[model samples]
Target: MRSLARCCARNERRRHDCKEYRRAVVTYYLGIDAGGSHCRCRLVDSDRQVIGQGESGPANARIGVEALKATLMFACNQAIAQAGLSEGDVARIDAGFGIAGIGRPGIKEQLAQLDFPFRSVRYETDAFIANLGAHQGADGAILVIGTGSIAHVRVDGRSFSIGGYGFPISDEGSGAALGLSAMRHALRALDGRTKPTPLSAAVTGRFDHDTTLAVAWMDQATPRDYASFAPLVMDYADAGDSIARSIVEDAALHVERFIEAVFERGAPRCALAGGLSHRMRPWLRQKTVERLVEPLGDPLDGALLLAGSP
Candidate 1:
């Protein structure tokens, strides 16, 4: 009878251990692509099946660490809720974050203090994630043109970045740059230093042709504020405005230069990924255009990969 009791006890202990093992093995994955304009999150199971997704406000590191954390938390909670997971489940998740301005001094250290309810976490720059996803982790290059511009390339396990400096002094082939140029042209036209076309007239109309008011607005304008006028430049260019066309063409040259530099560094493939990518495609040289390939995925996908990294 004692022997039978010992066998039953052993069976019970084995069952308990099995249950604990299963619980410990179950894992969830979260990927966050945190950009200047918005933060997006994706939750997936161990099998790589998406369970939920969410979005929130800007999480740019330049916006201040607290603000970035708030936006990231908002996105994370929404996704977790949508996945129908309990609060405790958050602690079982592994997460990866791809954030804009992460390369800025002290930003990485600042992110370390963020309270993420995950089993583990990884962080990478937005440009790296974009390039990673575009090529699906293979060696390649990506030129990202949005409110700002940056080029990233990976080749033979090494990474290189070019032209990611913020607006005014850099970010030459970016929406902010294009828009700023348009505003400058408008100012010149107002002073009779340049011929006023439909583009200049429309831009000047926003300030009632008052150079003083325009200058005042610009004095405190953020990059997003300047980028808001990019569509106007593109519209005017499409309408055959000479000044607008010149501005766009100039921007295209800068983009081409980025591509050439990337290829010279031995990247076997290249892609354009960002809000302005498709819009600028038509203006690229046929030879340059031919070298481009469709991105395999996006930054969010790259962020997911980071979650699985050691």
Candidate 2:
């Protein structure tokens, strides 16, 4: 019987096919969000199940290429082990990364040329991915106020950046911005140019009251140092200090202006994010409220979603 013989041949072929014979061939995609502070890596299956996860510290390229590579390897190896597979086990893989301090021109090219194991890889600024994560891939804007501040938005398949120009002269409406403002007030009071306030007392203690301290402090103050002073401004504001209230108010206005710029690009909604966003929301009055969008998930979780995308 030709039909019976053909069926037997088909069965034999299937039996001999390693791929077909394998009962469990798992597939996964990996997503990484790396920053100067920490890096998170996640692996997810088609179902969006978090099959694996890993974490490392300071994987930023600014820290050095060796540090970044080691961090990536450490995280990926942990994820691979958690998924019960080696890098070679996955049938198909895609990767997406959101990296901080990577907006420099040559960085993307460097990352593109990087040799890594994956089926496909896409790398973008953390701000872009944060924009995607906040809005669930919808076209909109995000206001990030943390140790630094930045406005990133996407519309018409293009990205625009506002603020986040580092600290002092730029980072308007950020913690650092407010801190610098506070320091200015303190210095004016110390120099007898303005009435002494609680801020003056606070600043003297912080700067150790060294002569010519303002000059040296300005030169040496990191973004985090300025951000650290943000709480002082908030405290004074709550205590009904006019100057502190105005400082925070100024921060709010700066953020609002940042959002307005993004909205001008045809973005229908804006999402407020970052450490300061939580407190900053209440500071936004009627206008910014109407334009803002609710976040879909946190950044690390967002990476997982991308990992599972078809």
Candidate 3:
């Protein structure tokens, strides 16, 4: 149940009838879509209007389990309050948790340790929800390239994914990876180890003209910090920085590998989502488009739909 301290005194919105029976039920659904930098919880009726919403901080597994629980609790409680519902009412509500941290070791165990008040719980990697949200229960694949990256294909409710492992060693074409590449280039330039580019200037200027400054920043910075610099890669690339352009091009290639993996599963349609989704679009290879997709809905909305459906 988390905490009722976040509850509201009045209902936020009215419920609607389920089309199947021509009967209006008081039931509602809750959806929590968590990320590396922010978490959002949405409440909706069977009809899928966003009746209530709440947001909190990052829930990435790399943040550790304690932080994950805290963030989920905070956002979920806010959503309960916003929906004008109480802890007890949630016992009848179905909830779907599409979280960034789910695929990590000990994640399922840690989540089971928590005591959320949902009547039922369906947990999955953020990538699955991203695909469902984008595909709307149809058979298709979705690539989510945010702080991390994963690609998933959905056929009738079953899902399969590729490459959502983590940073440096995995998660190709992700924001974290992009930033790491940018930083590598920045360091090389600073150490007189490589040719000059605006990226060096940008990185140096961003950190007060000292690449060493990033060491301390990195110590405090989560994956989000690395992902944050992903834009810098694009910025430099747009300005004709050869290294930056190369990074983006290489990233596009990495991203395609995931698409290819999904296509290998016989996926016919595909869509892209997350921070890097649109950014990588212009650079996407022609074959990737041969397996294109039109998104079904936003992830938050998809969460609500999953919760509401029987």
Candidate 4:
């Protein structure tokens, strides 16, 4: 009986030690979805269960490396704290970041070499991960229409992009573009060069209906600032304002062209993403509608998958 009792005690001790060892080897992951408007962080434990989430201000690459770093850290630390972990634990995590403007000249190289707190970090374009999440790692395409716009197609391990050149020159169907068009019409109305509609009056009124004042505002405005006026455009369009209708129709046509380009590239299906995706759906072409598929996940989910990559 004494020998049997001794064996039972020894087995219990071994089981406890084994559990401790397993715990010691467990890993954690962090996923960051950093866009022009905001930076978001999601933390998960070894089992892939979510621990916490946090958000902060914009982290666009154009904001430069130092500002981006500070916002990213702020968001990550918020998530870590919510997960009941100290900042020191950041060193033990693996991370993945999906950032806007990641494909611009030298942007990827700079981000890849950052002194991140994580043990390992991977980086991808926001559009790429949105494609990954939309199709759940399958062959598909995504049109991201936000403050800016871009389309990405993934097929058989190959990927391609369309539009998304940037503000003013590209991103034709994006919010910034729509807002810019609205402001232009408003300026023309103020100069008595165009028929002033309710939409133009309302838009110009924001700048006290003065051309000089509007120009002053534009001189310092960012993409997000322009995008802020998009909702007003949408509202005016919904109310059947002709000028607003024209701007929206033009944007819709651009979106149609983008989708047509995606299908032409051999994507099996496509999903629309970003702040304006759902709102723009009613304006999409029938052929584009036929090829649309519901996303299995979102960019954040794709980012998390990258975080756990071997």
Q: List, in order, the clash count of every candidate structure.
A: 0, 1, 1, 0
- 160-241: candidate 4 lDDT, tens digit per residue: 7887878989988899999999999989988999999999999999988988899999999988889888888888898999
Give residue 27's lDDT in candidate 4 (0 to 100).
80
Which pairs of residues have clashing backbones in candidate 4?
none
lDDT values, one for every candidate:
0.88, 0.74, 0.78, 0.87
Clash pairs detected, candidate 2: 270-293
- Judging by TM-score, tell me the better candidate of 1 and 4: 4
Candidate 3 C-alpha lDDT tens digits along 1-310: 3345334312222222234233334577888888876888888766666677889988876777777878987988887787776555677678888888687778888887777677777777777777777867678888888888888888655678787777768888989888888888887887889987888778767788686787778778767889888888888888889889988999999988888788788787878889778888888877676677768787876676566553
Residue 296 miss distance in model 1 (angstroms) = 0.6
Candidate maximizing TM-score: 4
Q: Give the local distance difference test score of model 3.
A: 0.78
As for TM-score, the candidate ahead, 3 or 4, is 4
Model 2 CA deviation exceeding 4 Å by range: 1-24, 36-38, 52-93, 117-119, 211-220, 301-310
Q: Could you give candidate 2's per-residue lDDT for residues 1-310 as a string of tens digits?
A: 9999999999889887865435245456788877544677888876667889999875656655556767876887788789887546654667778776677657777777777777777777666777878877777888777666777887878887777655566777877787788888878777788776786668766767654876788787666677778888888877877778878898888888888888887777888777778877778888668768788866655554555465
Cα RMSDs of all predictions?
A: 4.8, 5.9, 8.1, 2.9
List TM-scores for all candidates, in order: 0.90, 0.77, 0.86, 0.92
lDDT of 4: 0.87
Q: What is the Cα-based lDDT of residue 294 in candidate 4?
A: 81
lDDT of 1 by residue, 98-213 (tens): 89888988899988988777988899988888998898888999999988889999998899788887777888878889989999999999999999999999999999999999
Model 1: residues with Cα > 4 Å off, grouped in runs:
1-24
lDDT order, best first, reads: 1, 4, 3, 2
- Name the top lDDT candidate: 1
